[model samples]
Target chain A: MRVVREIALHVFKESVRDRVPYTLVFFAVLLMATSYLLGQLTAGQEVKIIKDLGLAATSLIGLFIAIFIGIGLVSKEVERRSIYNLLSKPVSRRQVVLGKYLGLVLTLLVNISVMVAALYGVLAYFWFVSDPSVKAGWETPALDPALMVASGLIFVELALITALALVFSTFSSPLLSAALTFGLFIVGHFNADLKRFDQIVASRPVAYLARALYYLLPNLTLFDVKAEVVHGYHVPATAVVSAVGYAAAYIAVLVATSVFIFERRDFK
Target chain B: MPAIRTEALTKDYSTGFWRPRPSRALENLTLEIAPGEIFGFLGPNGAGKTTTLKLLMQLIFPTSGRAEILGRPVGDVGVKRRLGYLPENPYFYDNLTAEELLVYYARVFGHHGSEAARRAGELLDLVGIGGERALQLRKFSKGMLQRIGLAQALLNDPDVVFLDEPMSGLDPLGRRDVRELILRLRERGCTVFFSSHILSDAESLCSRVAILSAGRLIATGTVSELLAFGVGGWELVMTNLAAATVARLGLRIARATEIAEGHYALELPIDAAPDGLLRELTAAGAALVSLNPIRPTLEDVFIKKVGGARERATFHHGAHRDHREKT
Candidate 1:
């Protein structure tokens, strides 16, 4: 466990020092400022506009970070031949895989937290000067507590995406890992539609394969309650719970596969 | 018990993506090093020296056979606590400073905070990098990185230290410092198993050495045992003499080399007596400075063994292939 912590801390330190994450977060914050300015252009719709744009920025930045940084975690170490020294220590490959996954997840969490804070800052400023507490289209207040629920699910989704990226990273090149991971992210979002493919497609074999893939593929739509949360509508607690549970299961499978591959990988 | 032991250990790498072929990287390597011995693993490039080291370090799994360190199986976590390894051409994290990198590795070995910091500082000074502890690794030179790599390997006060090409990427002074450090470790009863092409260092330091060629062990013995043949001949140095004087004495100087004006270095034949030469030098107004025997070196032994192996392997493996062909 200590070995895992050390590796994790090392990864976190490496990620913090890299310029990519900072650059992405800077852009996310820039988008937040853009959201604020765009909100000012509308009448009585500033709060929703800000929330919508803010969440989008968070999701997009989180996705990019999850793919780019996450894909390089193991592959970069291998390419640099640094993993040789680390593996020579008193640690197992399983521990290394877990540590890498957790560390990147920590980095993603911190970046998402920063983006969410920037969004709230925009909302707070609007509340301070305009004092527009209109509840016309909103089911909740201007400063909705349910917004955290949406962000938390975004984090869970990012965590799962990070695990996917890590799994690809353990065996493939960073470029290939990035391409596969981003492709999986795109597929994960649309797998929910695959569950109902039997109604749209007449071919029995295609429908069966789609149904099997629906169960196999990650149902990322379960995590995106952005619409309800943005509109300040009531998001059920059950939805968040199920999504969290699903993420845990998916991440476990991906991480176990990563460990299995890494254990057998030659550093030569 | 031996601090390190391997029993017919072997490794075959699967090459070719679509149709895998078993290419032997290390073949039936068997070895044992007693505790506190400075054992040198000597081999030419691609003679499976690094492969053997990696197998013992458990960085790569063996295809067959077994190995043990400190009576525990290879890859055992508890055994690794007592073991340290420095890879060939070691690469550390570029963002980390010497202090942070050492502290981080210390934490990997279970030390934390001030203890880790203390170990890092001690190692920095030990490796002569204390002043540069705070500097980032990216700015460091190759030799500096090698020093840091040595520091991290010693962080645990390990019972057995494995160093692959420990003298690589360093100046003579750096190599001397590392040699002294290895001596220090041996003084503290740490078994040092290092692989190096620099046989001169091995000849000076190692208690015993194993020579590998073509993925196989060709020789293993103490320095003296392998160099059992007596000194070849005598080399005599003298001054204030011309080459014509030596030609007159019927003193058959096997080889005569000039040192300076009116000075000469002379090599005597193996069976030739030095007594008459000394007398003749003094009578001929020449001063005899020194007489020394030329002993055979490890390089002589290495070339002989590798050369012999290549001749034998030519029939089976092929004549075109060098014995130390890259894996």
Candidate 2:
């Protein structure tokens, strides 16, 4: 347990020193600023547009953090030969994998939180300063209740992506792992549509293949509650609970697979 | 008890596509290094020295046979805690300072607070990196990096230390320092198993040596035991030796050469010693300038063993082929 914490702390400090995290944060902030501007162009739907764009920015940036950083965690260790030092210690291979996973997850969590805070500040600015009568029709004023729920769902989504990256990193090179993880993230986001297409496809064999892929790929769209929050659609507590549960199961399976592969790999 | 014991250990790596050949990295190697012994594992490139070390360290699993450390299986975590390894061409995180790197390892090894700090300080000084503790490892030279690697390997004060080519990139002075460190570790009753291609280094430090060639243990024993494998002979430089003196001794002169001031080179038989012969030569009117015995070195023994095996195998195959053709 102490080994896990030590690895986590080392990774976290190293990530902070790296410019990648700060660059992503800056991009997220810029995204929020652009969304605010877009809200003005949409006129009466200013708050709704702001919430949609802000949530999208958060999820996108969070996905980038998870895939980019997580894929490099183990692959970089192997490339640098630092795995030898860590493995030569009393620490097990599983501990190293888990520690890296948790560390990257913490980084993504902090990044998502900061982006959400920035979005909240933007929403709050428009809600208070603008005249309610003039911008009310242009904006359905941002609701704190829906935004909080949306953030919770996004966290689950990011956690799942982080796990997916770790799973790919265990067997593949960093570049291939990153590319495949990013590709998976894109497919996961549209998994619902892929399932729908599977049903509509004319060929039976092709439909079976599509259906298989849909089941294998995580349905990331299920965790997107930004649309509900944007239109003032009530997000039931049960929906958030189910999404959290799904993410947990998906991450567990991926992390277990990673541990299995890591244990067998020869670090020569 | 042996610090490390391997019984018929073997490792094979597959190479070539479509028709793969299993290249044996270690083949039927059996060795037992006792506790507190500085054992030198020597071989040329691709001779299975590193493969053997890896098997002992449990970095990779062997294809067959068994290896044990401290009476435990190679992969046992309890055994690992008491073992420290410095690999060939070790690399560390470039971003971490010397102190940070050692502290990190100390923490992983379960040391903490002032104890960790004090140990880290002592190790940094021991590795001669006292002033450079705060500087990131990226700025360190190859020698400094090697020293830092040594520091980390000693972080746990392990009972056994496995160093692979530890002196590869070190300067002469750095090499001397490492030699001293290994000696010090031996004084502390730590078992040291290190591999080096430099025969002199192995000859100087190792109490016992194992020579590997073509993925096989060509020879294993003390230096003198290996040297004794090759034929021993004595060389005598004397002058004005009577034919009677030579005939009475029955000494076969392999080569008789005249030196600068009327000195003759007399190569005696393998088992004959010049101790008794020298006194006889001095008693005669002959001036015995020099009498030196020519003994085979470890290098010679290694070459002979490897070369002899290849020649014998080739000879057997050739004879078998001729017999088949005749049949």
Candidate 3:
């Protein structure tokens, strides 16, 4: 466990020094700031516009960072031939996979926090400085604590994506791993549609295949409470608990499979 | 018990897309290194020296074989705590300074905080790179990189150190420093197993050596044992001898060159007895200047074991031979 943490800390140090994560974070903050400008044009709906666009920007930028950096976490090490130095240590392959995953997740967490804080700042600035009549007529407070629920879910979703990218990176090249992880991210969000199609499809074989895919792919849409929180509707406690549980379970499976594959690999 | 041992170890890599064939990187390599001996693995490029090191390090799995380090299987992670390896042309994390990189490795070995930092500093100093602690690995020279690599390999004070081409890419002085370091390790009773194509260094530094050719062990012995195994030729010189008289002696002269004024030097075979040749020279009225029996060097033994000079000429690129040998 200590070894895993050391590896994690080392990877974190290495990753934070890279320009890619910093660049992504810069764009993410810019997009959140742009949402404030877009909010200004919405007139009476400034708060709603800011909330919706801010959450969307946060998730979108988080996805890019998770997928791009996560794919290269191990693949880059192998390509640069640095894996030789890393693997020759007393640490096991399992520890390496876990450490890299945790390290990137930490990076994503910091970036996500920055975006979230910036979005909240924009919303707060509009709430306090806007016309007095406009502030009185607003239904929800600008600094809504409920927004954190959505951000938390996005964080969980990003963690799952990061774990999946690591699993692909264990055996595939960086390009292939990126493609596969992004494909799963897209397909995962629409898993409910696959189940719905199974109910309406005419052919038995097609229905069975659709049902299988529904269970196989992650239901990422479950984690999106942005619409509820943005519209000032209460997101139920049960929903948040379930989403967190699902993300945890899925990440566990992905990391375990990655460890198994990595342990058997011959760094040839 | 031997500090290191392998039983018919072999590694075969599959290649090609459609008509793939298995390229054997190492074949039935059975060898041993006793405790407290500096064992040298000598081979040209494309030999199985690095492959053997990889197998012992568990960087790659053997196709069919077993290896033991410190009386445990190669894959035993616990055994690695006492084992250190320096790969050929190592590539380390470029983002890290020497101090940070060493601290990270030290942490991996269960050291942390000031202790890890102290150990890291000590190792860097030991490798003669102590002054470069603040510099990132990216800015280092090749020799500096090799030195840092050696320091990291010794982070845990390993009982057995496996160095693949430790002398490669170093200046003559750097090479001398590494050779002396290896000697120091052996003096401290650390089993140092290193591979190199530089036979001269191996001849001077190693207590025993194994010469590998085409993924196979061709020769294995002490420096003296290998050199004395073959009877080398002889050298002879004559002064003030007439060309006609020298020709009349009827000796198989390896080479005959004029030395000083009216003096000639001749190289002869070991089978050509000096007494008979001396009598012939005297009868022919030729003055004998000098007669000496030549001793073979490791270079000669290597060329002989690896199918002579022609094969040695093309032995540097192992990957290229890996393909050709497959077909």
Candidate 4:
């Protein structure tokens, strides 16, 4: 575990010193522009647009961060032959996999946290300064507590994709890993839809395949609470817990599979 | 117990993606190095020196046989903690400064906070890279990278250190420094096993060396033992021998060159005695400036052993000989 922590911290340090987190600057600029431009909407809808756009941007940026950085975690070391030195240490392959996974998770968490904070800061201005007439028609206050619930779930979604990217990175090229991870992310989002595809499709073979896939692919939409948070609807405590638990289980399996492959690999 | 030992250690790599073909990279490599010995793994490129080192370091699994360090299996964590390895053409995270990279490795070895920092500083200075400790690795030259790689390998004060092609990118000065460093490690009772194609470095540094060729262990023995394995021939240098006198002995002489105005260098067979030649030269009004027996160098033995390994050079118990190429 100590080895895992050391490797994880080193990965985090590497990502920080690299240009990976420089994307945060882009996020900051986009937020400012989002606030100024989206303000053109009718007063009440303007706040709604900001909230919706803010959450959407956070999720999108987090997806990019998780996929891009996570895909390089192990593959970069292998490609550069740096893994030779690290693996020579007392560290286990499993520790390396876990450390890299958590490291990218740390990077994603920090980036998302900043975006979440900036989004709320934009909403805070509207909360304190908006016209009473606009506030009256608002379904929720600009600084809604439900935003935290939504942000946490968004992080959970990103963490799962990070683990998936890491597993692909253990055996594949970064380009392929990114493509596969992003491909899975797209597929996972539509996994819940696949359940009903069998009802809409004509062929029995296709319906059976869809039925099988509905259980295999992640139901990523379970973590999305953007609309509910924007409209002041309740996000159940059970749903948030369930999403977090599902991510944890998925990450465990992915990491184990990564370690299994890494242990058998020959760094030729 | 030997500090390092491998019993029939072999590795076969599969080439091609669709229809994989097994290619033997190392085969039946059996070796041992006692404590505190500077052992050199000498081979030309593609001769499986790196593969053997990689096998010892456990960077790759062996297809058959086994290797042990400190009398523990290769997978033993406690044993691993007491070992260190530097791979050929080492690379580190490009964004890390020399200091941070060392500190990170130190922490991996279980040192904490300031101790890790202190060790990092100490190792950087030890490897003569302290001045560049603040510079990122990507900004470093090849020599600087090699030095940092050595620093990291020795960071743990391991009982045994394996360095693959340690001289790959070092300048003569850097090579000398590394040679001295290896000597220091021996003085501290640490076993240093390093691989290289640079025979000169191996000749000057190793107490013993194994010449590997064609993925096979061709020979292994002490420097003196290898040199003594075969005496190539003797070289005779002389001056004041007239062309008329040289012509008279041309039938007896193999080949003669006028190295200077009147000086001649000659090649003699291993069985030839300089006494008879000296008598003839002295009677012919020639002065024998000096007479000495010429012995084979490590490179000579290396070439012979490498050639032999390729041409059914049966390994007898040591670094071997078909003799030397007489000049």
Candidate 5:
């Protein structure tokens, strides 16, 4: 466990020095700020626009960080031949996979936290500047704690994407890993549509194949509470628990598969 | 238990994309390295020297056979605690300074806080990188990187140090420093196993060496035993005698060449008694300069063991045994 933590801390330090995460977070903050200005032009629906754009920017930036940096977490070491130094140590292959996974998760947490803070700052500015006497259609304050539920689910989504990147990275090149991970992320979000196709299509084989894929690939849409939170609707506690549990299970399977592949690989 | 042992260890790699062909990297290598000695693994390019090192380090698994280090299997993680390895042209994390990198490696060995700091400092000085501790690795030269690599390998003060071409990217002075460091390890009773194509370096340091040719163990023995096989003969220097007179003597002289104004160099077989030659020279009123035995060098033995390029191209299994039997 100590060895795993040491590797995790080392990887964290390495990622902290990398500029990719910082650049993505900076752009997300900029987008959040831009949404504030864009909100005024929408009039009356300014709060909803700001909330929707803020959540969108946060999720999009987090996805980029998870896919870009996570894909290179192991592949970069192999390319640089630095894995020789690492694997020659007393740590097991499982520890390396776990450590890198934990490390990238930590980086995503910090990055997402910064973007969330910036988003709240934009919402706070709106709350302070808006005139209550104008009598807008909705009277609820834009700064709601309920939005955290949306952000938390977004984090879960990013974590799942990060695990997907690691699994591909264990056996493939970084470019292929990134492409495959992004493709899976896209397919994961639209899994419901694949199931809908199964019902609409008359061909039994195609429907069965589509239905099988829908069950096989992760259903990431369950984790998205952005629409509910943005419209000031309550997300059930049971939904949050199930989504978090799903993310955990999928991440475990991905990481376990990664460790299995990594263990049998010969660093020639 | 032997400090290191291999039982018919072998490795094969598949090449080509469309039509994959299995290329043998190491073939049925069975060898043992005893404790507390400097052992050199010598071979030319593509002789599986590095492959052997990698297999022993568990960076790669063998296609067949098995190996053990410190009485544990090669892939045993606990065994690595007593092992140190420096790869050929090693790469390290460039974002880290020397101190930070060493501390990180030290932490992997379960060292913490001030103990890790102290161990890092000690290794920095040990590898002659104390002054460069604050400098990031990206700015370091190849020689400096090699030194820093050596430092990281020694972070745990391992019992058995495996160095693959430790002197590879270094200047002569840097090579000497590493050679001395290796010697120091031996002085402290650490088993040092290293692989190198630098025969001269191996000749100077190794107590025993195993020479590999085309992935097969050609020879393994003490330095003196291997060199003793091809001792050329005895050499004699004489002067001041007519060529006709020397020819008239009928001694089995191999060849004679004039050295300076009157001195001549003479060669004879190992069995030739020098007393008869001395008596004959004195009788002919010639002066004697020096007589010394000519022994083969490790380079000569290595070339003979590896054979010429033509012979190497046709190298096959059981060839090492044929050469051994003939010798």
Candidate 6:
């Protein structure tokens, strides 16, 4: 446990010194700013528009963080040949993977929080100072509850992506791992649509194949609450609970897979 | 008790996308290195020296058989804590300074607070990198990097140290420093296992050595043991006069070269040269100026055992030939 914590702290320090985290933070901030600007074009639906764009930007940037950074964790160690030093210690293989995953997740959390705060600031500023006619669309003057739900949803989404990236990183090269993780992210978001398309297909065998793929991929769009935040629709409490559970289960599966592959890998 | 022991260990690398035949990296080989012994693993490039180290370190899994350290199975985390390994070309985090890198390693080994810091400091100084602790490793010279690598390997104060080509990139002075460090480690009761192609370095540093050729342990023992076994003949340089009379003494004249004045170089069969040949030359009215017998070196033993292109050259020149071959 001490080894895990020590490695986790080391990973955090390493990421902080690297420019990649700061670059991602800057991009996330820019994303939130662009959403606020885009909200202005919505005219009467300014709060709803800002909320929608903010949530989407948060999720998108979070995915980028998980994929780009998480894929390099093990590969970076291997490339630097630092894994020899690390493994030569008393540390276990599982500890290395878990510690690295926690570090990347912590970085993602900090980055996501910053972007969420910026979005909240922009929405609050627009809500208070703007004309009553522009603010009339909002059911409340304060921050929307749906946007909070969306933030929670994005956090879970990013956790899932981090696990997927880590799983690919265990056995594959950094480039291929990143590509596969990103590809899975895209497939996950469109999983529901693909299921619907499968329903329209006539052949039962083809439908079974598509259904299998749908079940295998994460239901990322289910975690998306942007539409609820934008149109002032209430996000059911049960949906949030189930989404959180699903994210946890997915992360557990991927982490296990990563451990399985890493255990057999020959670092030399 | 042996610090490291291997039992018929084998490793094979499979290549090709389909119908791949496994290339054996290490054949069924067994050896034991005692505690506090400086054991040199000498081999030509591609002779499986690195593969053997990798297997012993548990960086790679053995295809068959087993290796153990301190009586524990290889790859056991408990055993790993007592082992320090320096690879052929060590690469470190370019962004981290020497102090930070050591601190990081120390932390991973579960050391923290002042204890970790103090150990890191002591090691950096021990490896002669104390003055450059604050400098990033990226800016370090090759020799400096190697020193830092040595420091990192010693971080856990390991009982068993594995150094692969530790002197490859070092200058003569740097090589001397590393050789001295190995001796110091042995003095401190640490078992040092190092691999190198430099015969002189191995001859000077190792108490015993194992020579590998094509993944097989061709010859293994002390330097003297190998020389005694493989060295076929010796050269006896004589002088005075009467070459025909000296030739009639039944010692096959491997070579007879005339030096200035009455000095002559007589390269005779080693077995015949030691049989009262010096007294015989003097009694035959040939004044023996000097009688020098040339012994075989480690390189000769290595070349003789591992017969390749170089070994063929050495064979033509005979075992006692002293033509210098670059390692």
On DockQ, who's better, 3 or 6?
Answer: 3
Q: Which residue ranges in model 3 land beyond 4 Å of their true spot?
A: A24-40, B18-20, B234-293, B308-327
Candidate 2 per-residue C-alpha lDDT over B126-190 given as tens digits, one digit per residue, 9 for 90 to 100: 98887889998889998898998899999899999999999988999999999999999999999
Predicted candidate 4 versus true structure: per-residue lDDT over A86-199, tens digit per residue:
988888788888888888888888888888998888888877878888888888887888999999999999999998998899899999999999999999988988899878
Kindly list the per-residue Cα lDDT of model 2 for residues A200-260, writing each as its tens digit: 7899888888888888999998898888788877888888888898899999999999999
Q: What are the per-model DockQ values?
A: 0.75, 0.62, 0.63, 0.81, 0.77, 0.55
The candidate, 2 or 5, that scores higher on lDDT is 5
Q: What count of clashes does model 4 give?
A: 1
- Residue A217 in candidate 3, Cα distance off native in Å: 1.0
User: CA lDDT of B10 in candidate 2?
Assistant: 97
RMSD of each: 3.3, 4.3, 4.9, 5.3, 4.4, 6.7
Model 4 pairs whose backbones collide? B220-B319
User: Over 4 Å off in model 4, which ranges?
Assistant: A202-206, B235-267, B275-290, B311-327
In Å, residue A185's CA in model 4 sits off its true spot by 0.4
Q: List the residue pairs that clash in candidate 1.
A: none
Clashes of each: 0, 4, 1, 1, 0, 0
Instruction: Show what share of the native A-B interface contacts model 4 retains.
Output: 0.80
TM-score for the A chain of candidate 6: 0.90
lDDT of 5 by residue, A1-268 (tens): 8988888888879887777567655766576667657765766677777778778888988898899889999998888888888878898988999999998888888887877787788778777777775326654467889888899999999999999999999999999999999999999989989888856889999998998999899899999999989877889999999999988998999999999999999888
Name the weakest run of 10 consecutive residues (lDDT summed) in model 2 chain A. A134-143
Task: Please give, for residues B11-119, the per-residue lDDT of candidate 1 as tens digits.
Answer: 9999999999999989999999999999999999999999988888888899999999999898888888888899999998888888999999899999879999998
Error (Å) of candidate 2 at residue A216 is 2.3
Residue-by-residue lDDT tens digits, candidate 4, B97-211: 9999999999999999999999989898899985778999999999999999999999999899999999889999999999999999989999999999889889999999999
Better of 2 and 3 by lDDT: 3
Compared with the true structure, all predictions reach lDDT values of: 0.88, 0.83, 0.86, 0.88, 0.87, 0.81
Ranking by DockQ: 4, 5, 1, 3, 2, 6
Q: Which ten residues in a row have the lowest lDDT in candidate 4 chain A?
A: A35-44
User: Of the candidates numbered 4 and 5, which has the greater lDDT value?
Assistant: 4
Question: 2 or 5: which has the higher TM-score?
Answer: 5
